[model samples]
Target: MATSELIYSVSELNREAKRLLASHFMTVRVEGEVSNFSAPSSGHWYFTLKDAQAQVRCAMFRGQQQRLGFRPGNGDRVIASAQVSLYEPRGDYQLVVEHLEQAGDGALRQAFEKLKTKLLNEGLFDESRKQPIPLIPRKIGVITSPSGAAIHDILTVLKRRFPVVPILIYPVAVQGESAKFEIQAALETANRRKDADVIILARGGGSLEDLWAFNEEIVARAIAGSHIPVISGIGHEVDFTIADFVADLRAPTPSAAAEHAVPNQAEWLGGFRFMENQLIEKLRRQLSQHRQRLNWLEKALQIQHPGERLQRNAQRLDELEQRLNKAMQLTLKQNQHRLTLGSQKLKQFQPIDKIAQHQQQLQYLQQRLQRAMDLKLVTLKRQQAGISQTLQAVSPLSTLERGYAIVQQHDTSKIVKAAADVALDTLIDTRLAKGRIVSQVKEIIRD
Candidate 1:
């Protein structure tokens, strides 16, 4: 045996290394931060687990990834329970991760939290931005995978609870790499079509990676901007996505989404039956009350008799007539007494008796009238004597007897006794008390 010179090819050496590693470390738990974590199209995750000094390659198969609560991302510190193995083709040592947990702050969880905070600050997660789900949506648009169990669950619930509400499905990928874009496009289509009153974004329970499409910023914004109200029914009750925050309503399950969108037929029917019974009872009570009121009114009308009222009025009229006659008799007696008293007073002041008693006064008046006439005759005689005296005092004959004359200017009818009254040789008139003479001025005399 050539114990000193045994040779092996690279493939054989790699195979031998894999077998040795697998036998020594069948299962192990390692804690490190993930670097370059990636899930390719092959449904397998390849990543590097590194510490400060060293690093190791880790592989998670699709079956294990599906069972993980959260997806691993770059810089994620995690405790990975894996089988130590070597890649024959690549000639590298690696860890085949069977289970994993957050070692410290998970990279995926930190990213999720940071994005959530950013969206919240932008008002995308605000209650004011969230719309109200329709109580009775006429048409519901569902954005989900065509083959998912979520659709079937929602349809079954809606059909059983409210069959009248119509549902339209917009099929989209709910998992894997293309899921985010497909979900966003489905939401956009539902909005453009305007065919539905409300929209439902739903999926069955899955790992965080499987549910990542709902957490994408594009999908979250689409849900927030949709004119129709959105109900997020993604994953199980324990799982929450960003779409749940942005949607108008969040339902724990697909069935619960249907229940939230519309009211249950059985419950509605029960309420309607109760209301109907109450209405009927109220009507019966009202009718009975009205019937009682009618009977009372009939009894009251019987007590009001027109003939009796007229008879009572006539009795009152007769009593008033008797009182009026008594008043008239008393008035007549007072008038008679007043008339007798007035007659006695008239007898005391009778005009004929007064005339008879004043006969002497009448005689005195006559004597006074006679005296007045005699005095009038005497006063007339005195007045005639005074008139004679005044006529004697103003007599022109007396002046003529005194030899007085009056002269007048002939043309101007003015007295011409002075020389200035007339020019020389002017015509003049001279008058004695009894006569006048016409003369021409021959000489002037000064007085």
Candidate 2:
């Protein structure tokens, strides 16, 4: 044993000590006042837990911090569930905090839960009781510390989005014993003034104890009773206070509250421009349709005019006259042929009595032919008159005389039978009872 003596470095000694402490006191629960609490960027909480006679260093890793129901601060008495360990690098004994809660705060948590349950049963958190945020507020009232960063953040956001809206500040203490009373007073004052269209109750991020003022029952009741809509922007996004539930609206931050209270000027202007464009397009379409209708009417008037009717009637009358002349000429030719045949027959007989008898017969036949021609001519004249009358009855011009008009395109001279056949601003002709009119289309109505 004397010959086996071994040398050890400082690191090796510390490692052995850490291994022994970790193995023996694997788990523990300690009670003490938290002090020198510090949280670094690595998300580890470093603190000293001290009693009247003894003190120990503690470290709560990020994983353990997540399990804490309430944040622990300096002077806060807490029960820490931890593991006994040693820092191998420093060779110092410590407790590795796995879970932590405020000393005797279990009762407070129970009370909070009970109150939350009671209020929920009473319907205080109903969505129907929540008020709508004004899209564009005339004035925004803020209830917070005058010197705090919450007020500055809110003002900055409002100025950026909508600078025209005025702001009213209701300064109040955001912490400590009198903080809840001060907050309630500010809320009442804002409502009494009735100047602000919307109100923002705001505070910066803080620990659970620091934000306890917002969890007061009086603050919640005051927010619910406010005539003006209240928006709660207390603490960080992860923190929820009683005031948040009773508020008309909830924002994650003070700056976000300002954003919810008013409309952005740029967005509103863009919307107005959009609506104006739509109205202009509608008017243009209406004008085009009206122009089409006017053209159609003008064409109808020109087509139905008395002048057009007269010209068409005259042309038809010429056709009738030509036909009558041809019919009379044919009849005359047939009678002339019959007379020549009879004369030939009488001449071939070569007898004086036959010639005299034939002459008398020819005279009588001539008289009878004359009578037949007169009767036939009368019949043909009557037929022609009747046909002319029928044509007049059915003529478009006649319809125009009876208070109708015909529509046609001036360019194509095509009849317009339906509204779809016409277009806006087209040159159209209309025939009336007396004259024709050429006009551009102004409007058209359809069913």
Candidate 3:
């Protein structure tokens, strides 16, 4: 079914095969015996790798051989880390090697890497997934060989740190193939018993094979699944295992793990003493505050007491009464002084004395008026006598005696000084000194 132009030549076929093999396969580890091993002066290694029934050509170039932990020779069992490919020039199937290690450790190293990558992918090695160790555990459980040095170190460290805390030991084999099962059962038993606040999975330093039991997947999973926090102190500081990676805390050694599990007694006692002093200080302040509040309340109650209020008001009333009496006395004294001044002014301008003086003056005026009247009467009498004597000298009565008569109108009693004074039809009186006569005129005559 192939096209003529699609056919591959010998060299082309080999090149095509190499490309296909390299693309289809990843880097792989092959464990077998080395045969026909040769190291050229060019620093290239060429060998044939075989098992009991199969063989394959292999090449470890100088670049890869630099990191080799051991020399590969004929009949030596080893592991080759290489790419599966065809040698293009020779048109042969071969392994292009990158590394070589002794098989004993090489297999375990491969298994360790495999399991490490698996648990890492599943997040068992994540810091966020790990639980925090308690500040002070009530009880500590240890899973290790009871007769081993690791248990002794753990117990000694724990006793020195905090001897009062109890310890529960689950004895197990930490080295053999059955060690993984024993450790896992101890973890489960500790959890079921619910007696430990924390558990320690510990072992002393050993070769990888000796430590293989701790690297089992069952033990790693047991640590990952524990409800209580676990501390793994497997091997020395330089040695690490799967249990260390999955545990909540990984200590360098068993003694260090024990140290991490508990707090010192003296330090805790010092902290408690400090707290007790603080509590006493707080109580004293509260008591002082309450006493001050009570005193304030007592004073307030006294201020509002009815008897106190009445007494204060009575004192105020007495003060006001005294002020009123003083004001009235001052007003009365001022009025008395004004009345006394008014009485003195009245005495200085009294009308009774004035009336008496006026009466005396009136009496004197009356006396003078009476004397004047008497003198006036006397003067008037003298004037009357003189007037009488003078009137007698000029009296017409003598002329009447000489026979002279005064003619007058008889009705009027008026003397007629001339004839013109008499009316013609009137009676006339002829007045002599002795008597008067009335005469009637018969005719008018102006003579």
Taking all chains together, the TM-score of candidate 2 against the true structure is: 0.56
Write the residue-wise lDDT of candidate 2 on 38-73 in tens digits: 999998899999999999999999987776567789
lDDT of 2 at 446: 82
TM-scores, all models, native as reference? 0.49, 0.56, 0.55
Cα deviation of 403 in candidate 1 (Å)? 99
Candidate 1 residue-wise lDDT, 115-145, digit = tens: 8999999999889877887777889898888
Output the number of the TM-score-best candidate.
2
Each model's lDDT: 0.83, 0.85, 0.85
